[model samples]
Target chain A: MIAFRNVTHGYGDGPLLSDVSLTLPPGSFHFLTGPSGAGKSTFLKLCYRELMPIAGTVEIFGQDVSHMSRDAVAMARRKIGVVHQDCQFLDHLPLADNVALPLTVAGREANPEELKELLAWVGLSGHARARPPSLSGGERQRAALARAVITAPEMVLADEPTGNLDWDMSQRLLTLLVELNRMGKTILIATHDMNLIRTAKSQVAARVLRIRDRTVQHAGADL
Target chain B: MKAPLPRKFRLFGRDTRTDRVVPPSGAAAWLTLLTAAAMAFLAVFALALSVATGRLADRWSEALANGATVRISAPADQMATQTQRVLDILSVTPGVETARALDPAETQALLSPWFGPDLPVASLPIPQLIDIQETPQGFDAEGLRLRLSAEVPGATLDDHQRWRRPLVAAADRMRMLGLISLALIGAAMAAMVTLAAMAALSANGQVIRTLRLIGARDGYVARAFVRRFTTRTLTGAAAGTAVAMTAIALMPSAGDAGGFLTDIAFQGAEWLWPLTIPPLAAIVAFVATRTAALRSLRTVL
Candidate 1:
């Protein structure tokens, strides 16, 4: 449950996302679509409290993001999973350890069986012993997805999950996200890929919101 | 059904995976260790100096506090008579414990180092010296000086206060200087450790960002750096302390040749003091690294 109320954010210049208001309800799936440099990634950052709104308020789990302490922000992040466009990983570590990082940071032991199963779900079962730098682009994206969901967070926000993947791989990753949504996990993905959006519509019902002219608008069936 | 709890999170526990999150900073690690060793070596010497100077001060104060010297300078014919008169004055003094005039052989032995062994003591007009020991409650030197001036014009009573006070003060000042040197060494170690930690934190910025993305707190991130530095410092300091203690143990003892520099070593229970350097170095490293890590984490994370 993340809500942005009339949030306006920008770099030093003018606002890139202006007067935006949106609510991500529990167990709902949404897709953010826009042209390049249209503040889709910035919007995603606001949801996870990585960047605060310069104007208006951003709330995560009914708590104001601006008022939370650094420690409180970390605790709030445990409930939200984010997948970056580059799919960051601790390259020195093996794939299994990288995926189990969330549990480790939470000061809990990673279950070997659960990790094995999660790696299998992400099609990274064979690459468990391999380092992150050795994985392919699609494998790395899937591994990032596995890491995101390993904590069983309530909400998942992904930025350009399929930017570096082929069509087949993108569909595979989309299917994985659809399966998670079916299991009652709220999902919001930001991307400029129209084909991926059409494909996502065939698999599951997802509302598409397009960012244009520094504002978010609900793009109905026309998109 | 409930899951079982994990093992206790030990402060010194070895978690290879968690430690690997921040890559080993090879140069910084070696620098920290070497600096800690050097500081610890200097710290051991400083401690020895402090303890040795303190002992010297106490010895000098105790030996000089209750003693005085009566020097009788007279014509060669009246030397024995003047010595006899000085001894008689000391015997009647209230706080005089024992007084004896030094024999010619004893005076020759005292002057042997300066004038060599074969000096003709009977022919020369050397003054007669009477060694006087005082009671616990010593006699007043002013009163004794007036009496000696009135009774025997050639006799001067020196209570050794002027020389003894300065000697004791010099030793005490040396002890303070040793302590100040130790403090400066500790401060230098801390500064070096802080710089090394900052460099490591800056070099591992990506590692910190990745850790923060995964919901790791500042304390968790700081622990990785702190534990590494503290262990390195402790190990290095232990090695330095061991070497220093061995070197001190092999130093020449202060027996007959009681030169000040020769006695610059631990005495008796004082040997155990150097053993504290390792733990103290570890504590310094821990504090320095923890401070640098947390401050840098705030900026980067």
Candidate 2:
């Protein structure tokens, strides 16, 4: 669970998002939509403690994100899966190894069978031995997804995960996310694609939140 | 976080030793091996110099501190009389163990290198030398000198104190200088290795950033580099030490006509002393790299 109470974030002299109050409960599915530079990624980053709130409080699982120590934040991140916009991977490692990185960072053994099954689920079973740089955008996204879920985190946050995918590929990725939600993993996705938001709505009870005028608003009511 | 992970975790985790080895190319590994070997070679000699100087100081101080010589430079007829009188005085002296006049052949042997074996010592007015030996509770030089001056007016006493003091002092200073040089070499090695580690860390910024993005604690990331550099330094030091030891072992022994420089080597159990350098180097690398990594990580993060 995550709660941002009147949170305000900014760069040196400009406010990106201000007075943004929101709550994401367990097993909830939410879509964040906004135009370019709307602070969607920054908002998702705060959820996992990558960037701290400049003002106000961001809480995850009852611990204050801004107050948590570095180790505490790292341990907390083990329970939250984050897929970056670029779908970052350790380039030198094989795709399978990259996907198993979460388990590795957590100091847990990666079960070979479980890793194979996770790759299979991401449709990257054939690319297990392939290096991350050799994988296509879609494959990279799927691998990032696999990495995020490897620790069996309770929540998943993704930023434009379908940005480089075709319609069919986007749908396949969304279906994977929906299945995770069905299995009780809370999910929040930030995207600019309205079609993707509409598609996610029809499949699951996902609420759409739009960042406008430096504030988050319920999308259905406004647009 | 929970009671600190085992060293096995530190050892086998992809982050530490396995990740940084850069896959050994024969050339690179050999270069590392050679570097270690050469440094070790020099280090061994430095160690030997330090130990040998210490021994020389101890020997010079011990041998010269407890002995004196009496030389009588009179006519051959008076030489025998003066020698007998000096011996009579020494017989009553407190710490004089024995005083004996040198025979003609023994005197010639001392002068052979300078004046040749055919020098006419019987005709020329060379002084008759008395070789004096002393007990641990040595004779009073001033007291015996006064007695000899009164009894044998032509006698000149050489207690070896004037020359011995300076020789022992010089040896002691050389021993100190050798120790100081060894310390400076260790410091220089640490500084060089620290710079190398920092360069390596800077070169691998992407790796560090990736690790950080994945939520690795600073300690985990630091340990990766710390262990890496520690091993490199240890290996380097080991190679350096081995080459140094072997080269020192092959150095000319003092018994040979080897000059002082050639005679610089470990004696007795002094050889075991170089074994401590590798572990010491490892500790230095650990501390130096850890400080560099932590400082750099803090600045960037």
Candidate 3:
């Protein structure tokens, strides 16, 4: 449900992602792969309207990202879930409260049973009372994943979801993502892990895109 | 089956989840409270001064508006004749309510404070004084002065306007100054609150970023800070107002002491005015904090 038409972005320097045109259709699963500093995180930011494209237009759910007001951007974000590489959380809050934050910010009543089941699905049921800083890296990633899908958003954009996880933990996280895709949720993940890509391809029908030398290219059957 | 999640309490019509994200900045919180308290205390005094000066101006204007005094300075023998001539002139004046010359003993009473009660009144050269009372629509002092100068050259009419006008004007000016001081105090409080809120927002930059990333709107983020500062200001101002009202109540009454300082206090229903300070302080804090929070959130989110 996200479209970037010739979207060019930069940070006071030259363009990071130049003349990039891509479409993330509904119920589709895609992987973004490139080396370090290949503008992968920047691509996900544009998808969520965190950063506006300097050159062309970026659209989410058919609304122009650059034209949306601050409040409209926030409302649009509720429809798309984002899992960051750092797995940002309010360190002062417990893990359960952090995961329930999306519903809380939207001014909706949190269904305790649903929140519990979501936490259990991500295997963070026992760690609900724990703080973010107190949790292990892998546990934090799972908590982040649970938080992302807590709102039942239509699309999920994750930036290096398993950056800090081991091989088995990464596989487990991949399985959760695969299940979500099977349930008709669009998923786009950016990563540099080739093994994670290989594992994801065997589990689900997915296309791979890579960002290199300031442009996005469809990597053809290389994996 | 998964266990049910416990419901958290809602504060100020919103769930407390958003508020818990920002860690409390203890120093900034206390600074806002103390600033509000101090500003409120000063505001009470300013209100009192304005009210008291207004009363003083009204009293002076009413008492001195229609009254005049006739001072007769002449030879001892001619003083009686001049006084009689002045009295006769005043009796025909349309606005003159009553005119009576002061007796020797009454004149001595006026001088008792400076010359002691046993002053030699008969031998002294103090001028003969005649008190003149006017109707509600008073006579013209200039017209009467010309009449007395022709009929009784030694007689001089003083309608108390020379001194009364200045006294009334001074009181009115004091009232205006008191009001201006209250306005300045309010502005200063707002400025201090704005600075404190900005500091708190800056210190919690990470918290704001995290909240916005989770789809929290600017209003949601601003409310958390606004409610906190408003509550603190209200509580502190209440305490300050209580102390100020008690101090004002203990002040000497104007009727008993009869002086400027004694009159600088609340009288009757005027005590109810200071009670509004706490609520007003809360409003100021709400506006100041909301403005700072939203402005800072723009740069953050």
- Give a tens-digit lDDT track for model 2, residues A69-155: 777777787888888887877677778878887776666779999999989877888999998889888788878878888887899
Per-residue lDDT value at B37 in model 1? 86
Worst 10 residues of 2 chain B by lDDT: B16-25
DockQ pick, better of 2 and 3: 3
Residue pairs with backbone overlap in model 1: none
Report the TM-score for the A-chain of model 1: 0.94
Q: Which regions of candidate 1 fall more than 4 Å away from where they truly are?
A: A202-205, B1-10
Give the native contact fraction of candidate 3. Answer: 0.60
Judge candidate 3 at residue B130 and give its lDDT.
91
| Candidate 1 residue lDDT tens string, A162-184 | 88788877887888788889988
Off by over 4 Å in 2: B1-35, B254-256
Look at candidate 3 and give me any clashing residue pairs. none
Better of 1 and 2 by lDDT: 1
| Model 2 CA lDDT for position A151 | 83
**After superposition, candidate 3 runs with Cα above 4 Å error:** B1-15, B254-258
lDDT tens digits by residue: candidate 1, B76-138: 888878788888888999999999999999999999999999998988988888999999999
Structural similarity to truth (TM-score) of each candidate: 0.94, 0.90, 0.94
Give model 1's docking category: medium
